[model samples]
Target: MTWDAVIVGSGFGGAMVAHRLISAGARVLMIERGDWVTRGEAAWRPEASFELTPSYARDIPYRCDRGGHGTTIGAVACVGGPSVYYGCVSFRFRELDFVGDADVVADSGAAWPYRYDEIEPFYGEAEGLLGISGDDAGDPTAPRRSRPFPFPPGELAPISMRVVETAVDMGLSPFHLPLAINHTASAARQKCVACRTCDTYACAIEAKNDVATMMIRPLVERGMTLWTNTVALRLEAEGTAVRRLVVHRRDSGEELAVEAERFVLAAGALGSPHLVLASKLDELSPARAAVGRYLMRHDNAMIFGVFPQRPDPTRRFHKQVALHDWYFGDPGAAEGAHLTKLGGVQQMMTPPKELVRAHLPLGTKTLLGGFTEQLTGLLCIAEDQPRKDNGVSVDWSIRDGYGLPQLVIDTSYTARDDLAVDVLARRARQILSNMGALLSYTHRVKTFSHAVGTLRMGTDPETSPLDGDCRFRGVENLWITDGSALPMSAGVNPSLTIAANALRAAAAMVAR
Candidate 1:
C-alpha cells in the first residue's frame, strides 16, 4: 500500500505532521525505531530511568568526540521520543530569537527564513494540542500571545515557592514554567499526581501529555498506520523525488521497502543527517556543504544549592519557576562580551538518591546518600551559536546490529558558548545563595537533549539545505519538519518550537 505520507520518526515533528495529515483524510504511516513504553509500577521506579535501564535505549551508540575526549552514548529511543522523558517545559521562542546575531551570522550561516509572527497561530495550536498549562504573567521576554494557554497552571509546591520568593526578593521576576502535563481532572485523561519521578521517568498513569499520549495515540485511532520497532535504513530516490524508504523490522527481522507519495524526515538532528548522508542524498542537494553543518545544542549546566536543612522534606514536585532577567543579555555585563544573547534559568529538582550514590566515592557513598534531601538545583540554558566545523558524520568501519554504519558526532563548545553558560551559572548560584544556601556547586550537562540546526532552512539555497517552507532544496516530495530544520536555537526549551514548525510545514505540504 502506498501511503499518502510516510513519516520517518514519531516525535514532535513526525507526530504533529501525522496528526495534521491524518485528520485531513490522508493515509499516513508513522515509523518509530523504538517500541511503546510499558507504563506500570516499573515506570515510576528508580531502576527504570534513562541511565539505569536499557528498555527504551537506542541499540546503536553514537560515537562522540568533545572536550578532547571520546565517548559513546545511546539516545533515548521510544515511540514518543525524548518528549516522554522531558521535563515538559513548553516555551515559544522570543520574537527576537528569530533574528540572528550579527556575529553568529558571520561565523555561521544562521538565519531564520520567516519571522515569529508567521508561526504564532501554529504555536497556539500546538499548545492546545499538548494541553499546556501556565501563566506567563511574569515572563517579560515572552512573545505576544494570540490566546491564553489551554489550562491554567496548578498550585505551586512548597519547595517551588521558596525559589519564587527568593527570586522576587532579588528583584527578579520569575514565573511558572509552561508545562505540558494533564493537570485538570477529567474522565478523558488522568491528572498529574505531582510526583518527584517526573523529568526522567515516564508517567505510569499517563498523566504527562507527551507525543505518544496526546498525538500518536489519537493519530492511530484516526486510521494512521503506526509502526514501532521499525528502523528506517535510507531513502531511495530516483531523479528529483524519493521513490521509497527501506526499513528493517526488528520483530520480524525482515527488510522491506515502503512507498509513499510524500516523505517527511523527522528522525531528529543526528538521526536525520545520518540517514541522509548514508543514502548519499547530499549529492543531490544544492547546498551540499550545508547538508550536515552548523550543529547547535544550547550550552547547559546544573547549579546545586547545598543547604543546612532538607529543602524538600517530603520531596514533592518542584520543577517550576523560570528566570528570564538575563535572557536577552546581562544588564551589568561589559560591552563586547559573550553575556550578550544569554539564556534563561529554571528551577530543577534534586537528583534521586541512587543517582547521587552512583558517582560518589565508595567510602563516602553511603554517608553522602542522605545529603540528597538537602539539595535543590537550578538549570542554566545558555544560547549557543552554530559553527561550521561541528556536525555529524557516519563511520563506515563500525556497524550496528542492523548492519548500518554507526553515527559519528564531532561537536564542541566555543569560548563564547562557555562564557555565556558561565554567566547564567553565576546568576543561578546567586539565586540559590539568596535562599539561605550554605554553598553551591556546578555540574555541566553533556547531553544532546536540545539538538538542532543540521539541515537548516533559509532563504539562500547556497547556505541552507532546506527551503523557506522546509522542503529539501532539490527533492520535490521531501520535507524536513524536525528540529534539524531550525536555523537558530533560542534560550528556552525547543520542544514547542519544533511542534509549531511541524504544524506549519504540514499545512504547506498539504497545500502543495
Candidate 2:
C-alpha cells in the first residue's frame, strides 16, 4: 500500500508534519525505528538510568568524538524518539535568533533563509496542539506571540520557588518554564502528579504531553498508519525524485520496500544525514559538500548545589524556573564583553541516589549516596556556533548489524562555545551560592541531546543542503523537517522551533 506521504522518525518534526498532513486529508504512514515505550512502574524506577533501559537503542551505537577520544553513544529510537523522555520544556526561539550574528555567519556560513514572521503563526499552532502551558510576563527574551499560551503556567514547587527567590534577590528576573504537560485535570488525560522521575524517564501516568501522546495517538485514530520497529535503511532515489524507502522490520526480520508520493526525513540531525550518505544522494546533489556539515549542539552543563539540608523534603518535580538575564551580552559586566550570544539557565531536579552512586568513585559513591536529597542543580544551555568540521559522517570500513556503514560523529565545542557556557555556569554557581548552598560542583554535558544543523536550510543551493522550504537541493520529492534543517541553533530549546518549521514545511508540500 503506497502512502500519500511517508515519514521517518516520529519526534517533534515528523509528528508535527504528520499531524498537519493528516489533517489536510493526506494518507500518511510513519516508520519508527523503535516500538512504543511501555509506560509503567518499571519505566519510572529510581534505581535505573533511562540510558540502560530497554527503551533506549543500544544496538545502533554511534561513535562520538570526545576531545580526540572516540566513545560509543547510545541513540534514542522509540516512536516518539527522545520526546518520550524529555522534560517538556517547550520554548520558542527569539526574533534575534532568526538573523544570526554577522561574525557567526562569516565563521560557519549559517543563516536562516526565512524570517521569524514566516513561521510565527505555526508556532502558535504547535503550542496549542501540544497543549503548552506558559506565561510570557516575566520572560524578557520571549518572542512576540500571536496569541497567549494554551494554558497558564502551573504553580511552582517549593524547590523551584527557592531558586526563583534567589534569582529575584540578585536582580535577575526568572520566569516559569513553558512546559508541554497535562497540568490541568481533564477527561482526555490525567494531570501531572509532579513526580521526581521526569527529565529522562517516560511518564508512567501519561501526563507529559509528548509528541507520542499529543500527536501520534490522535493521528492514528484519524486513519494514519504507524509502523513501529521499522528501520529505514536507504531512500531509493531516481534522478531528482525519491522512488521508495527500503526498511527492515525488526520484529519480522524482513526487509520491505515502501513507496510514497512524498518522503519526509525527520530522523534527527545524525540519522537523516547518515541515510542520505548511505543512499549516495550526495552524488546527485549540487550541495553535496554541505550535506553533513555545520553541525551545532548547544554547549550545556549542570551546576549542582550541595545544601546542608534536603532541598526537597517531599521529592516533587521542580524543573521550573528559567533565567535569561545574560542571554545577550551584558556590557556592564567584565566578562560580558566576551559573551555575545549565550543561552539561558533553568532549574534542574536532584538526581536519584542510585544515579549518584553509579557514576561517583568507589568511596565517594557511598558518601554522596546519603546526601542525594541535599543536592539541587541548575542546567546552563548556551548556543554553540556551527563549524564545518563538526558534523556526521558514515564510516565505509565498518558496518553495523544492519550491514550499513557505521555512523561517526565529529563534534567539539569552540572556544566561544566554552566561554559562553563558562559564563552561564559562573552565574548559575552564584545563584546556588545565594540559595545557601555549602558547595557547588559543575558537570559538563557530553551527550548530543540538543543537536541540530547538519542539513541546514538556506537560499543557496551551492552552500546549503536544503532549500529555504526544507526541500533537498536535488531530491524534488524529499523534505527534511527535523533538527537537521535548522540553519542556526538559537539560544533556546529547539523542539518548539522544529515543530513550527515542520508545520510550515508540510503546508508548503500540501499547497504544491
lDDT tens digits, residue span 2-40, model 2? 889999999999999998898899999999998888887
TM-score of each candidate? Answer: 0.97, 0.97
**Model 1 reaches what TM-score against the true structure?**
0.97
Candidate 1 C-alpha lDDT tens digits along 371-392: 7888899999988888888888
- Alpha-carbon local distance difference test for all models: 0.87, 0.87
Scanning candidate 1 in windows of ten residues, the lowest lDDT window is 331-340
TM-score of 2: 0.97
Assess candidate 2 and give its lDDT. 0.87
